[model samples]
Target: MTDLLLPLAFLANGLAAGVLVGTVLGVVPFYMTLAADSYVRAHAFAVGRYDPFQPACLLVTFAADVAVAVTAPTTAVRVLCAAAGLAAVSVVAISLTRNVPMNRWIRAQDPDTLPAGWDMDAFRRRWARWNSRRTAVAVLALVLNAAAAVALP
Candidate 1:
């Protein structure tokens, strides 16, 4: 019932959430990316497809990332969490700035339309890279958070 225990518990929970997301996302990167890509290809601008659903997932992932950052006991643990968070941040940025717009455009298009100036190959490649990086970050974050919870008072 100490302050450290409470934070540690929170961190632990975040780690669990991160693991769950990593598993699901890792398995279906193409579906996730294509859905967003398709949505933006149809729409004219970024509206963040899967709006309600995606935010919750992101919240859990980011919460874990932040919890580890604050609760980790050692400098090395903190640095690891920080690096993971940076990777997560990059994924989030790419999703918002690049993928979301593309998804929005995709949503607006007919199957034949191809959403104006959409570049399917480029989007796929970029998303694949970002997703891979994000997954790595999430995995590292979970490890660091778990380590922190164990090491911290």
Candidate 2:
């Protein structure tokens, strides 16, 4: 059972990492190409779709990191698992601090009829900047999780 847990944990971490990488490389770029209203609408739609699955992925990955640390076969494996867990925590911190508020602000606006004096360009720029940073953090977490997996005996 302990042996099986490591592989399952790795699978969960890998799946979460793949989704994060895909969002950075695929979804964000596509969203950037749209007109302001379209971008708003598209993102709102995308978020609706993404919210269902992404949170589960992150949770599983985070939980698995803890599990790995608990079941680690060696000191090095425990350290690697702890590092991976820290990285996962960082990803959550970035999302809550940077991404969630921005998303909430975006969701509050009417995509079809943005309010007067709305600074669409600023919104786009800021969102992009924060998203890029979040993506980088997620990538680091993914790498750390991968390292932890490799260190498992």
- Which candidate has the top score in lDDT? 2
**RMSD per model, one decimal:** 5.8, 1.9
> Going through the candidates in order, what is the number of backbone clashes in each?
20, 0
* Candidate 1 lDDT by residue in tens digits, 1-153: 224443543454354445435534653353444554453443333233344444355455455555666766667656655555554455456557765665555555665555566666676566556545555544565565455545544
lDDT against true structure, model 2: 0.71
In model 2, where is the ten-residue run with the lowest total lDDT? Answer: 1-10
Candidate 1 displacement at residue 126 in angstroms: 2.8
Q: Whose TM-score is greatest here?
A: 2
lDDT of 2 by residue, 55-101 (tens): 56666767777777887788777777677667666767777787778
For each candidate in turn, the TM-score is 0.51, 0.87
